[model samples]
Target: MSEALALFASSWFFVAALLAVLSDAFLPLVPSGTLVIAATLHLSDTHTSPFLLGIGVALASFSGDLLLLKFARRGAAWAQRRLERKPGAASAAAHLLAALETKRARTIVVARFVPGGRTVLDLAVGTTDRPPRRFLRWSAVSSAVWATYIVGLGFLNEHTFDTTWLSFAVSCLAATAISAVIARVVQRQRRLARETEAVEPVTVS
Candidate 1:
């Protein structure tokens, strides 16, 4: 308990957390959300403020997203070429483009929860003809939502359960389950969109 409190109270710990969440904007498998959850759980009994941590994490993630968006916008052609070389990324980018056209904010928020979706969507948005300000507004919303959800999960679990491991385990399981469901929904939406596009007839005036 003492060690956990010491680590959570250290300034370096929050710095590392910010970096991890920031890097996760580029790396899909960084487990940034999990790190936030763990930190929240550990800091439950400490003087460290979970609300402040969540805000810091959200801002860090928002910064990373904007940075990536700028890179994608400047290197639009290069980013598109690279994404095309990867089948999964290419498919995701296509769906994200379609989704963005209709449901900008919701798509951004949903994609943030789906593994690897954020990177693809960010690149797609950057390369599109849409206004950058729109992406910026929606990205901020998604980041705040993500941070709040992860931190709240950990905080509630910690207070509800006496055993530390049990709380952590339950929180992780819940997070994973939610992630999986969102991914499945995204996949289904993409499939339906593809079929509709294929069936639609093209007309030349």
Candidate 2:
């Protein structure tokens, strides 16, 4: 590895990344994306390997998924009771359930990329009785793709800019823009799904 790469490749950063991702599972406000962007910028400037960066992110994310899954498994009944008491939670759960019916793996993967979407989906998955093996299988793919694509975006921005700070600014702006777009798209899809549901006729046996 190059000197620049070696400088940031310490166990400390790897641990930090792991912890941030793990916490972000429950805390949607965590700056995991910022951390990944900063790490990628460092490697890009030094002309070193970013493969390990990708690995660190993906594994940490997977760990978070497992943690939430376990929590959901244990507290599903209690959570459901509470969710049913809250109108917002009930609506979110209904939308999540509807999405699951349309596409399970793809929904998981898409949500992983959207801001705050992962937390909702994680809780949804846990609240439902999705098998561990199936959830793991889909989560593995989602985590891997999210890490690679997001980090790759950082690399792209760095290559386009002359300074690390400049790239970081551009990348953060782009992330915000993407998140807004994703939120809008999700809202539209949910609206359409709800409308479709409302119009469907009920039949008597």
Candidate 3:
């Protein structure tokens, strides 16, 4: 993997980072962190500063996210049509859309770490009345922080970073598990709120 990234870094850093970000936006399990780490490792190995690699990764990631947001806004109707073909999927889809449309600010910020939430958040923000500059600012900052952490991990583990994909895999698993627990907690809270609303009495004229 290290060798592959080293070869890619020579001539394909931009493309690789762009695809990594796009994949990360749609597929949480894709290990985008690993890609950034690998890129930084390769750069460090070649006597190049990791900062350049980090900047490249961050820019590519931010660009990919913005593109996804644009697509989500313009293609939502088509996406809905496709999603409607699956059983029991339309209801959940509708619920997610409603949540995005109604809770753009909070949802976009919090959904940064949640699996499958990145694209949703991007789409939500794109479709809403929020300022594009604000969304871009927040998303870029978050992407930079995320890229830095992963790249820093590679730097710290430079000795065995390439040899032990297991370590990174374990970290990804841990993050996913924690995110799942958080999602469950959030869902429970939403359910409680709905229940409370359901039981509220109607006013008489």
Candidate 4:
């Protein structure tokens, strides 16, 4: 792991950041915050500009988000069909499809902070037929904020690995918890909307 980190850090911080961002789209196992921190550390050692590193990471992350969103829009049915081919996967797939159909906006916005949820959110938004422009605008803003927070943490504590790791872990946990809360709120709002529509009186013309 250290060797991989060294190789990534040695080549170019921008490349490392780009790869990290891309990996997040499909593989949540990749620790984006860890890569950002590692890149920051390497840049600091080489006297590279931290601001540029941050920008590179932000752009790369946004690109990944955009790609996932496009895939979600164009490939959802294909993906579902493929998933359905696998025995015992139907139940999970059905639940995911339902979630994608409902609470798309909330899922996308909240999943920006969750590890695996980012790609899922993008696909959900796409499958639900949410406007691309609106989703992209919000996604860009969210990615910027998320990147800034992680990068800022690295910048502040450049020398302490223990402190940085702890901070990153806490941040991830907090983000996940917040996402759960948002999902609940969105579900409640949808239920209320349905109830309201059901109760409205119809006027005969």
> How much is 61 displaced in model 4, in angstroms?
0.9
Question: Best-fitting candidate, measured by TM-score?
Answer: 1
TM-score of each: 0.90, 0.84, 0.66, 0.63
User: Which parts of model 4 are misplaced by more than 4 Å?
Assistant: 1-9, 81-109, 159-205
For residues 1-205, what per-residue lDDT tens digits would candidate 2 score against the true structure?
Answer: 5754666564456567568877898787898887787778877444557788888889989989888878877999865765576556667766876777778888888888777678777777778765778768888899999899768888899899998889999998887788788878987988887898889698999
lDDT pick, better of 2 and 3: 2
- What lDDT does each candidate get? 0.85, 0.79, 0.62, 0.64
Model 3, C-alpha of 160: deviation from truth (Å) = 8.8
For every candidate in turn, the CA RMSD to the true structure comes to: 3.0, 3.7, 4.7, 6.3
Report residue 100 deviation for candidate 3 (angstroms). 7.7
lDDT of 1 by residue, 28-64 (tens): 7898887777788767455678889889989988998
For model 3, the superposed segments whose C-alpha errors exceed 4 Å read 1-18, 26-29, 40-43, 82-106, 129-131, 157-163, 201-205
Which candidate ranks first by lDDT, i.e. highest? 1
